[model samples]
Each structure stands twice: as structure tokens, then as C-alpha cells.
Target: MKKKLIQYSDGYLNRVPILQFILVTLLFPLWGAAASLNEILITQFKVVFELSDFATAFVQSAFYGGYFLIAIPAATVIKKTSYRVAIIIGLLLYIIGCYLFFPASNMATYGMFLVAIFGIAIGLSFLETSANTYATMLGPKESATRRINLSQLFNPIGNIVGIILGKYFVFTDGASLESQLAGMTPAEAEVFSQEMLQRTLVPYQFILIILLVVLLMFLFVKFPKTKPETSKNVKNKVNLGETLKYLSKNNPFKKGILAQFIYMALQTTVWSFTIRLALEINPNINERFASNFMIYSFVAFFVGRLIANVLMTKFKPTFVLTIYGIIGVAALTYTAFVPNMTAVYGAIFVSVLFGPCWPTIYGRTLETVDDKYRETAGAILVMAIIGGAVGPVVQGFFSDMFGSLQLSFIIPMLFFLYLAIYFLSENKNDSHVKEESKIA
Candidate 1:
């Protein structure tokens, strides 16, 4: 029976239903743009609202927290219903969240913005949980990672666009908002703050329109349903105790979750503070100029995906992951010790290593788990994205305590060190499973 499924999947993968694949890939950039735009919000809100580093870090907390909160439930939904239903639900939530930004800006409260971000995150969580599984299912198991990487290549494109929009629309000025506000009187500052908050509405309003269009398209388009044999027609019952028992015995799965948590934390902290790191190195640099560093990171990320795709073809994903982890440690060493422009560029350079970590980890772990448990496995991994929420706050706390964003990079350095250890450990155990490594 399994052999028959494999033969069927090979035929399905050969042709790969081009139009359906393109439609699914189209959803990739939307959430990517939403997630990347958050860095701009962190910077803008910090100054406009007079927030501490720790307080500003809550922007990430609220954003990724939504993912942690929704991932497990979304997994159940996908397992119980269908991927298409999950995606539609996700899109609707995204639309509501994007439209809420208008009222959130009017309310002009940080908490309201957090609520809006949380709503958007709920949508993203749903989309990501369903979309990732769907993408992998679209092709043969051997080419699953390759297919996911091809689709994910668009993610950084969205990040670049988000950064550009943030540079022009959200932040809008060359200098820091604080610096500009310094010249304003109390009355003028109030007006300026309101106007700055209002500026956020434009991009989010545009996002709302885009989400609505995507939602309608998905509703109308007929997606090829390639439901997993394990999940299809199975009764949906989320037994936490059973899931926990299964995970506890699966060492590779456990390690993969830890690696994912660390990777997410590292990625979120690095991107969230890249601007601050740049400004620390050059205080005269404007917010718009500093944001260009983010564009560089995303560009590196895009390029890294392209390169990693090729590398994965020739080597084991675990082997390549270990090598990237080593490079990350070296780059982060420069970031932590050197406080010059060289260190800031080193920070940007780390994105190349960071780029493939998530997908690699996802692919690696998906291979480790039993077919019956894959959906739950994906959720647990996504839930581990809470690392993004927790990591930045820790880094932000360190930044505030040490009064140096450069020094705070030590947090991410430690994260990369753990990833190196995890990947190397996996590589050693993979000695007998060369075929598994290649596919992973």
C-alpha cells in the first residue's frame, strides 16, 4: 500500500500541477510582508510612544505570540477539516487584522496595536500551518524540501518590499522620529504623533485590499486535494497526553524543536534590532538609511535560499545545516566582539546562515516523525516559534541593561552555538541514513 502511494506521488510530482502550485506560492509573500513590517513598527513605536527597549520588544511578543497561541488549534482544524478551509479562515482573520489597524491607529494605544498584530498573527498562524503542509504534499517526498524552498524564495521578496514600505510609509522620515520630535513643542508633538500613527494606516489598508482579493480567489479556485493518507478521513481527536508521550520518545524530533526555537529567536532578535545596531555604530544615520540594512539582510536571505537549494541537492540537509550553523557562529562572533561597521555588516551577513535554518529544520523533523503524527509534529514546531516572542525580549532586556545593542548580540551568538551542536549531533546519528539526509 505504501509502495503504491509512493508510485502515485511520483507521477503527481512529475507534473506538479503548475497552476495550483503557483496559486499556493502566491500566499507565501503576504504573511512574509506582514512579519517583516513588524521591525519598522518596533522602531517607530519605541520613539513615538516613549517606550523602553523591553516595552518595544512586546511588538514581537504580541506578533509571534499569536502564532504560538493558534498553531496547535490550527493543526487540529487542518486535520479535521481541509487545508482549503484552514486557508480561508486564515485569510479572513488577516483581513480583519489589517483593517483593524485603521481603528488601532485612531485609538493610538500601544495595546490596541498589539491586539491588531495579534489578530494578524492568528491569520498567519493558520495560513502557515496549512500552507507548509500543503506545499510539501504537492510533490514527491524526495523533492518536498526543494518544493518548499522554491515557494519560500518569495518570502524574502515580501520582506524586502515590507522594509521599503516601512522606510517610506511607516517611518517616513530620514532621521529618527525622536530626533524630529525634539524640535517640536508640546502642542506640535501631539499633532506630529497623531500624524505619524495615521501614516501606518496606508500600508495596512493596502494589505487589507490584497487579503480580500486573495481570499476571493482562493474561494473560487479549485485546489488539487492531496490529503495525507494518515490524516484523511481520520477522526479528529487531540490527545495531548498521547502527543506528549510520542514526542518524549522521539529524540530527533525533540532536538528539532529546540533548534527551531533557537533559530526563530535568533532570527527575530537580529532583524528586530538591526536598525538599532546600525545606529549605534553610526548615530548620524537616519531611520530610512538604517532600514536599508534590513533590505540587505532580506536580499542575503533571498540569495541564501537560492544557494541553499543548490547545496541541498548535493549534500545532506543536516550536513549543510551544520556548516551554516558554524558560519553563523563565526559571523555572530564578529557581531558580538567588534563594535564597528564591520560588526554591523557581520550582523547582516548572519541572515545567509539564518535563511535556510527554519525550512531545513522543518524538513528534517518531518522526516523523523511517523506519518500518523506529522500534522501534530508540524504544529509543535510552529508553536516553538514562541522563541521569536521570548528571544527578542531577552535581547532587549540585555540591551537595556548593558546599554549597547552590539553587546546584546551575544544572545543570538549563543543561539547559533546550540544549533551547531544540534545539527552536528544529528549528522553523527545520520551515519547509516545517507538517503534520509539527502531527502531531508
Candidate 2:
């Protein structure tokens, strides 16, 4: 008799739905481009609005604040509905937010631009909450970390594209906008400000078109139903009180939340200040030239992610993460104490070290979580992204208080140090658990 074949419901052998996984992975870069573009906006807005460093930092504050506020609601949406539906909702919010940029530019209102950014972030929050959790569910639990890291590999591609867009389109190559505004008559300055604001909108307009195409793709694609969606139990409703209590007891998840928060803060603060630091260190370069360093940083980030993907397959994710974290702390320490062009390079190289920290923390955190609580756990993790909002502002404050941008590098250095230690401790805990299990 011929051997019988086993049938899988979701996909081949119930393995990863390759096409669906690709589509979901694409979401990483989309949000990444948006996030990195904010770095350019920070530089542009500071000059255009004649704002202080602290004021300019509000750009990130508004953007990530949206993530913090909407994360739980987004998780709830995923629990109640499906990841596809939540992603569609996210895309819609992203589209709406992109559209608002036009009106914001036309009105020449900074506040309106912030509102637009917040809307985009809300969309991003939903996408991140859903896409991240969904990616983990795409394969076996054992490979989840590697799988999420693979998806995140595309993120730096988006970051690179974003920086390139800003470098070429958003930033002007000439006398600084501040200098140009100083030379203009009052009426000319108002007209010029409007013109510059409109120019800044160009990249967003392009991104909007891309978002629309992706949205359509997402709308048409049939995603595999994962555990959360496949369940028929009525008890799946997300109870914030109970969920919080459960997650609170999970030591790894709690620590992961804290680590994610610090990682975001470090990432945002580092990128936001990259151009500023370059300009400060190399006073002759324009913003356009300064942006090249940011691009280099993004490239380093991409390379680091690729390397981490390989490394994680061979070593424990926590062990690899610990090493990366140590190197990041060392790099940033050099960056803080030594305010030279080489130090700036050190700051740029830190991006490579940072590449794996987020996904590693995220994947490891969720590993300890029950499948039933995964969506809520993922949402809370995304909410930790509020660190992005808070970090830059804190760095800006330090820069303003001390009248030294380089000294502000100390903040991220300390943050990196904490990550190194946190993961080191986690490694010890994992070993202990394994020993206990073996003994039993």
C-alpha cells in the first residue's frame, strides 16, 4: 500500500506560511522608515520654527506618545478580532496621518504636524503589536526568536531608505535654513517657512503612496489564522486587570519590558542627535552632509542584524545579546568622553550593537508567556516604546543644561550598560531553569 500523506490546515506541514510571513515581515520596514524619518524632521523643525532643542524633541514625544496610548487598545483589538483586521486598521490610520501632513504644511502649523505624527504612530502601534506577535506564531516556538530577527532585518532597510529620502529631498544643501531665514525680510521669511514646510512634506507624500499600495496588498492577502484567532473559547476577552497581574509575575516578561523601554530610549536618542552631533563636531558640514553618518549608522544596523540572525542560531539569544550590549556600552562610553570625529563614528557603530537587542528581548519575553496572553503581552511590550518619546527629550534637556551635546551621550551609555547587565542576569536565570529541569 502507498504511504499516506499528512494534511496541514494552515500551510505546508503547518510550517511557516512563507508568503504570509513575507507580507507580515514587510510591515517592519514600513514603520522603520517612518521612525527614522523623524530624525530628519527634528533637524528641519528646529531650524524652521526657531525652536530650542527641548522644543524640537517634542516631535518624537508626539510620535511615540501615540504608541504608548494606543498599544493596549490595539492589543485588545487583536484579541477580539484578528491580526489582519488590526493591521488594516493600522494602515488606515497611517494613511490618514500621512494625509494630514498636507494640511499641516498648508497651515504652517507645528502643532498640526505633531497631531499628524501622533496619528501615524497610532497606526504603527497597531502594526507593531500585531505584526510582532503574528511573526512569532508563524513558526515553531523554538525558532521564534530567529524568525522575528529575520523579519526585523528589513527594518534597517527602511531606516536607510528614510535617511536617504531625507538627505536628498527633505534637507537642502546650502546655507542653513537658520542663516537663510536670518537674511530674509519678515514677509519673505514667512513665505520661505511655508515653502520649507511644504518641501518637508514631499517625503511623507511619497511614503503615503507606498503605504497605500501596502495597505491594498494587506487587504487582499489571506493570512493564516493563528492560535489567538483560531480559538473558540469565550474566555479570550482581554482583562487588563488580570492580564497585568499575570504578566507582573512573569519575571522575564517584566524585565523584558524594562529592557525594551531602555533600548528604545537609547535608539531614539542616538539617532535623533546623530546629525546634531555631526554638525557640532564637524562644523563645516551641512545637514545634508551630516546625514551621511546617519545613513552609515543605518547600514551598520542592517549588517549587525544580519550577523545577529546568524549568531542567534548558534548561541543563546541572551548570550549573544549580552555581548552586543557590552560592546554598545563600550562604544557609547567612548562617544561620551571623547568628543571628536572618531567618537562620532563610535556612536554610529553602536547602531550595529543595538540591532538585535529589541527583537531578542521581545522574543525572549514572550517565550515565558502563555499563548492565551500573547497578544496582550505583545501590546504591553510595544507600549514600552514610549521610551523613544522620553529618551530624546531627556538628552535634549541634558544638552541644554550643560551646554554640551557630547556630554549628553552619557545617558545612552548608561542605558546600554543596563541592557548588558539585564541580559547577563537573564542568562544566569535560564541556566538555573535548565539545571532544575534536568535534575527533575
Top TM-score: which candidate number?
Answer: 2
Candidate number achieving the greatest lDDT relative to the actual structure: 2
- TM-scores of the models, in the order given: 0.93, 0.94
Score each candidate by Cα lDDT: 0.85, 0.87
Clashing pairs in 2: none
lDDT of 1 by residue, 1-440 (tens): 12222224221343366667887888889988998899989888888899988889999999999999999899888778777889999999998889889899999999999999999999999998888777877767777777777888888888888888888888765667778899999999989999999988777877877888889888998876565454344553436667768888999898888889998999999999998788788888878889999999999999999888889889877789899989999998899889688888999999887777888888778778765576778888888889999999999999999988899999999999899988888887787576777889
| Clash tally for model 2 | 0
Residue 179 displacement in candidate 1 (angstroms):
1.4
Which whole-number lDDT from 0 to 100 does residue 201 have in model 1? 78
Off by over 4 Å in 2: 1-13, 229-238
Summarize candidate 2's per-residue lDDT along 1-440 as a digit string, tens digits.
43333223331224677788999999999999999999999998988888878888999999999999999999889877788999999999988988888899888878999999999999999999999988887766667777888999999999999899999988888877777888999999989888888887888888988898999999898876575433455665457788899999998788889999999999999999989888888777788988899999999999998888888779887898899888898899899888689988998999999889888889888888876778889999999999999999999999998898888999999899998999999888889989999999
Cα-lDDT of candidate 2: 0.87
Each candidate's clash count: 0, 0
